[model samples]
Target: HGSNIEGMLEAVELADGNPLHLAHINAYCRGTVLPEAEETELALKALAANPNISCESYLSPLNGTSAEIIDGLPGSMVTRRCLKTGGFTEDEAGMEAALLSGWAQVNYPQGQEMTLLTGEAARDYWRGQQTLVSVSFAVNPVGPRVRLATAKKADGSFAVDAVSTDGGGIPRNVLLAAGLALVDLGGLSLQELVAKISYQPARLLGLANKGSLTAGRDADITIVDRLQHSAFATIIGGQVCYMDGKVLGRGGRIITTAAGADYVRSQGLEPLVVDLADSSLLQKAQKR
Candidate 1:
């Protein structure tokens, strides 16, 4: 599971005769080598076609972009350095450098050119420089050319705009609080990513009774509120438990004894009966 594609393929072949609950294929994008887009698409299609296989792609935007070194001393100096090295024009290099340095106002769709440096080439570019800038740069002809500004709106809310970042959509859900941080940074919304985590794992595990909210089945529910950006409650097996917000207790008849009391009496602790004085335990038990 941790090795190369050949090793993973070998493992999958070994597991073919058995049941595989989950299998995560590591598709590292090393400057678009090996698992290229075409190869990855084919692999995914093939995997999906297999009845026993469920595949997940761990993609990162950092792998597709060209790397560039920018000087921080001055915009002009950085521009000249980039141009002299035959990597980027003065304006392009200046804009890129400024963007990297927290200045996202250089301009839109700047024609910044940089050698697609990797391996030894990338290392050599940073060897002598005191501070070298490197970013995974992707160039696509379809979308807008300018980088979105990471600024707040007039109402103090974050401006909604798309900007490029690293990592696949998978880790944005299962990685704990870091996932929320990634979402806040415009990587992906928690709700959108959590849905993938909820269903994809179930499908991979081949669990027909779970992974969804439907009738005539165990109540496996994950209640979330879009406004709060968190799971407010969860229900399982017809039991519900509040997680984030408080729910007031309602009036109900207390069950002093039940038919199951005989089973406890058989254990010889005590044949006792108690009122339902506390409801929290009942609430939590219902959730399970």
Candidate 2:
């Protein structure tokens, strides 16, 4: 969530070893203000030294976050930093002006995509729909993204951790396609790509049975055409929930840990406990 790896590491140290999932880390790995490649190398080195932390990066170049102004200030720290780094005004008035000038993009929830907003139109939109808007920053670079995607551990598992979309309804669902692209480009093997997208994330969430094709596991699967590099089918628990752009049925069920066992059972769902130590994040940290 932070751009400065040093700052993030300090925060982790201050937290006294709490498990942390650093989100969309590649967004922070490259930038204009800081030394670019050095930042990512330092971040990865720090990560290797501390296994208590894990991170995931989206494949896309644009980073998205809420555009809320907190007490006349930017809502997202990254947005603030990006604004300043890009030589734009970093204050509230500057942000408003930037939006109206079509320099910054606004993601309207109803519109479902990023678009330029400006002038009275921008102010009117913010006044009427502030709560329903997010801003996009073109801060992510491809070099760090590819390096992070392909980084591996001693056992050949991903070092940067998981493949994140940071995309659900916002529609940046390119994890599988982009990962496969990486594979095709020789940046990573197919198995490593799968681990980054599935196994590693499942391990992080402590969902031991959800990431792989092993017997007796959850049949959650995403069937993608290797040639097309796209997903045409998605199955959950042996049920074809989605295929060919059509929803078959609402087949999802709640999945939780032992700590939430009472709630899971109360909701008529089964509890699944995966040892936190089973995660490669912690496993690698222990080795350190």
Candidate 3:
């Protein structure tokens, strides 16, 4: 919700003790108020002091948003922010220029996997799709991403709650490959790495049965290639959903809070209800 470290801190103060979850904390620390790492430090400090707020960030340099243009400007606020950050106008003409110059990357369909397209091909794909595709821009820098993923508070608790892809609904999924890189670099231990990507997040969401490999816990697992640092297989609820480049699971149930169940059903999705009463936010509030 905040644009920079100063605004984010001000926003947290403005909430007046309400529970908050800051999504993609690294994306906002673009060296506006200070250097990127300095801004990140300020954010971590604020988060460490406040138990009411929880947050997550990713390692991808690319940020995802809608490619559509309505009237003259981009339709999504996030896309406009990215274009402005890249020194481009918020209008369709600027978007076209951005695509032509390879700054705006369109998610194009290849064989089985989605890949990035730039320059003329990207521009044409966007136009051909009637400007209704997802686009990405290299807006996130490196320093803040690294710091947020592994920073700890005075009590040794994680400053940020999880490592998330932001699910920009594009190809920004880099949690495993990138997080393993941190492990290899000694930024995190294998156990701590599992917690950030799994355990901590599961606790935040109140998924009591998921996250760990302990006895009586759900067997949701992601097998990874230690050398390549990519995912090899995925098991959900003790069911092997994916393995060896084949998708065995048919569809996914939507993970939603009580308030969102009606909408999930409206979208023809089966809802896997999770209670916010058990969520980390309310628990943190109780501690406070």
Best by the lDDT measure:
3
Q: Give the Cα lDDT of each candidate.
A: 0.37, 0.73, 0.85
Candidate 2 contains a number of clashing pairs equal to 2
Q: What would the per-residue lDDT of candidate 2 be over residues 120-166, giving only the tens digit for each residue?
A: 67667876875347776667788888887777767665668888766
RMSD of each: 19.2, 3.7, 2.2
* Runs with alpha carbons beyond 4 Å of true place in candidate 3: 109-112, 259-268
> What's the lDDT for candidate 2?
0.73
TM-score per candidate, in order? 0.33, 0.81, 0.91
Instruction: Provide the lowest-lDDT 10-residue window in model 3.
Output: 164-173
Off by over 4 Å in 2: 12-20, 101-103, 111-124, 153-157, 258-288
lDDT of 2 at 195: 80
Which regions in candidate 1 have their CA more than 4 angstroms from the true location? 12-22, 27-39, 45-51, 56-195, 245-288
Candidate 3, residue 56: how far the Cα is off, in Å = 1.0
Between candidates 2 and 3, the lDDT winner:
3
